[model samples]
Target: MKLSILDQAPISSNQSPREALQESLKLAQAGENLGYTRYWIAEHHDLPGLACSAPEVMLGYIGSNTKKIRIGSGAVLLPHYKPYKVAEVYNMLATLFPNRIDVGIGRAPGGSAEATNALSDNFLQQVWNMPNSVQDLLYFLDNDIPTEHHHARVSASPIPLIPPIPWLLGTSKKSAILAAEKGLAYAFGQFMSDQDGGAIIKQYKDHFKPRKHNESPQVIVTVTAICAETSEKADEIALSSLVWGLQRKRGEETHGVPDIQDAKDYLRNEKDGLLDDMKKGMIIGNPQEVKKAFLTLQDQYNADEIMIVTITHSPLDKIQSYRLIAEEILK
Candidate 1:
């Protein structure tokens, strides 16, 4: 399986913007050395913890730093951005990076209502129209549809002769059907539990029809991966990072990741809801344990690619986790 890195660039307590960006670059460099196929940044707006609000700009930086690893959005949160603009940005990246840029698109806003409203006026409508809007965006990027014939036309300068590989990022069956119909690759989020990735992969492969851009179906699974010396250590590291997600679910708007002490204290006081959520879907363990779990997932889904998202309070810890996984499971 091909290994890739997915980063939300979570800002930890006492970390500045510059520090976060530098840390992300360090992680990207580490992934490159570890033989990862790609490094993807997630888009999340108006959130203090997530500094990857502008993935395209961040991708340009990542592209400049890494020599061989591919750089792109794990997802660009298509709903908030204009489809034409996204096509142009990704096309430019592909041109700059040649064969090393990927464009993974998703429907979610990756933020709360207040944040979404702050980013765009029509965020809700844009999200609702994503399935159709993305189709149009793909058409413009892949084919030269004339402006006169079509009411709207989007043209890019130094047009991307080589199209970026398209990936549909979702955690639902609806996304699977759309990906299959479009013959695009699908990446299932590891956080979701109601949807079975194996079933979706089967549906995608069975119903796939080749388009001009894609000749076959490709399935990728994105999982929360934290590999350390032992399962207990991995879990401890993961628990702290995961508290941010739990807080979000609880409608709390906090910026930056909490410290291990803070997370431990919070978990001790509150009910185990957050901890339960993490254990239910996450993969946190040592090399052997993680490998066993991942192998089962791969075997069940017959996944073509695996993207690992390592969430941590420290960049060094994050890089170490990914490094351990690459050295042991991926080797």
Candidate 2:
């Protein structure tokens, strides 16, 4: 199975944003060396524990540092920007990287309500007009705006010889349908969504309408996982993210990912069931067990690739987890 990374640039309790981004670059380099297919960075804003706010900018740094493996935005949060501008930025990236860029798009605001307000004038309306925006963006990328269209005379400049591949990132059936209708590859964010991923992906394939000759539906399933030499160690590493996620859900502001020991202490008074529920959406195990879980998800979603998101208090541990999973699965 094809393996890839989806990095959120999670900041550790004692690490600066610069350090987290440096870790992201190291992870991308490691992924390429391990024979992974892609390395996608996420976009987040006004989130203390997450460092990335501009995936395009991060991709530039990563692309210069790594070779071969595809580099992209996990999802560009399309609702906040103009289609033409988005096309211009990624098209320039495709030109620089040359057949190694993927432009993953999403409609989510990618931030809190206040952040959303700060980023866009009318976030909801922008989301409601997502389909048209997607079409416009795609047309700009292809440099094929219809003559009758209002913006026909304009162009998304710096067009590359080969355009970047577009993947629609979503978590629901409506998103699946939109992706299918647009003939874009669909990436389901299983780590974030509570929806039936298999059903959603199946719906995407069922409704897929090719925009180009010989085009076919493509799928990627992104999941949260932590792999180590032993299941116990993996579970221990996962606690940091689990506790941090809980705090976020409870509307608590955290400085960064708590230390593993701190996570253990915080969970002591919490209900055991809360931790169990969080684990339901995550695959925390040894290398072999993690591989098995990934295979199950692959078959269930009929996915072409598995994009993993691993968060830990130590950046080294996060890199180690990816190494363990890659060694076992790619072997």
Candidate 3:
């Protein structure tokens, strides 16, 4: 069982993005030392609280700071990018750090309409053609061109000896099926959904096709967690993240992660089911309790890796959570 991290460069109301980013770098190095297999950063636009807009740019910085943990995008929105450009950038990364980069793609806009438009024109049209774009990306990476292929002349330059692994991010069975058909590994965002993902994972594994990078089915389950010394303390520390999830759902413009008092204040006014919904994929408990809870998901999903996404108002808590998990469970 391997543990990995998915950092979104969380910002708290009390701190600036500069501090959040520095913490992200420090956390990545800490995870590397703690025996984490990978450290992937998420790309979110138009969300002030989520300070990671350019995961590719951050990957270079993270790769340089960490020794062994694989550094890559938790997801790069495929629809917004030209496949060739994505290939070129990640290819360069692979050259710099061989056998340690992952190219995870997602279909979500990662922002609002205005932000999507800011990224590219006809964003939805590109989204509608996502399958084609993914195929193009694969072809570019493998340097393959079908007979009479429209892009026969095009090629991803400076192809490294070790290519970045392709990961498809999704939250449903349909997404799993699509990944299987494309011969790509699948990562289910259990953190994003409020449902059990065992069925979808089963579907993906049953239908997966063998490819060069993955001859067998590969699956990673990403979920939220906050580990501390005690359950009460864990819940208190997780307050900010719990509130942030609700805020994102309510369509409110979040600044940074909020404090325990803010979380309590927000929950007092919100609907009864809001916290319930946020708790669906989250594991909040002490070190031993968290280990037990995590094992349940890992068992149900039969996961190759369990990716943890932690959020806290304090960088110290965030680092400490990963540290406790590493010392008590991951090792």
Q: Please give, for residues 1-331, the per-residue lDDT of candidate 3 as tens digits.
A: 8899999998899988888998999999999999998999999998768889999888888888777789989899999999999999899999899999999999999988889989998888998898899989998887776868788888788789989999999998878988988889899999887555999999998998876653888899998899998998998898898888778778897778998898898888778886776676689889999899888888999999889999999999999999999898766
TM-score of 1: 0.92
Candidate 1 global CA lDDT score: 0.81
List TM-score per model, in order: 0.92, 0.98, 0.94
List the global CA lDDT of all models: 0.81, 0.94, 0.89
lDDT of 1 by residue, 1-331 (tens): 6788888888887798778888999989999999988898988877767787788898889888889898888788888777778888888898898888888989887877898888788987887787887787677667566566452554744477688888888888888888888778788886554677788778888988787643877887888888889988888888777787788778787767877777887788777664775577788899888888888888888988788888888777788898888888668
Candidate 2 vs 3: which has more TM-score? 2
| Residue 162 in model 3: lDDT | 88
Q: With candidate 2 superimposed using the best TM-score fit, by how many Å does residue 203's alpha carbon deviate from the native?
A: 0.7
Best by lDDT: 2
Off by over 4 Å in 3: 265-277
Name model 2 segments beyond 4 Å from true.
Answer: none
- Candidate 2, residue 190: CA error in Å? 0.7
Cα lDDT, model 1, residue 51: 81
Q: Give the TM-score of candidate 2.
A: 0.98
Superpose all Cα atoms of candidate 3 onto the true structure and report the RMSD in Å to 1 decimal.
1.8
TM-score of decoy 3: 0.94
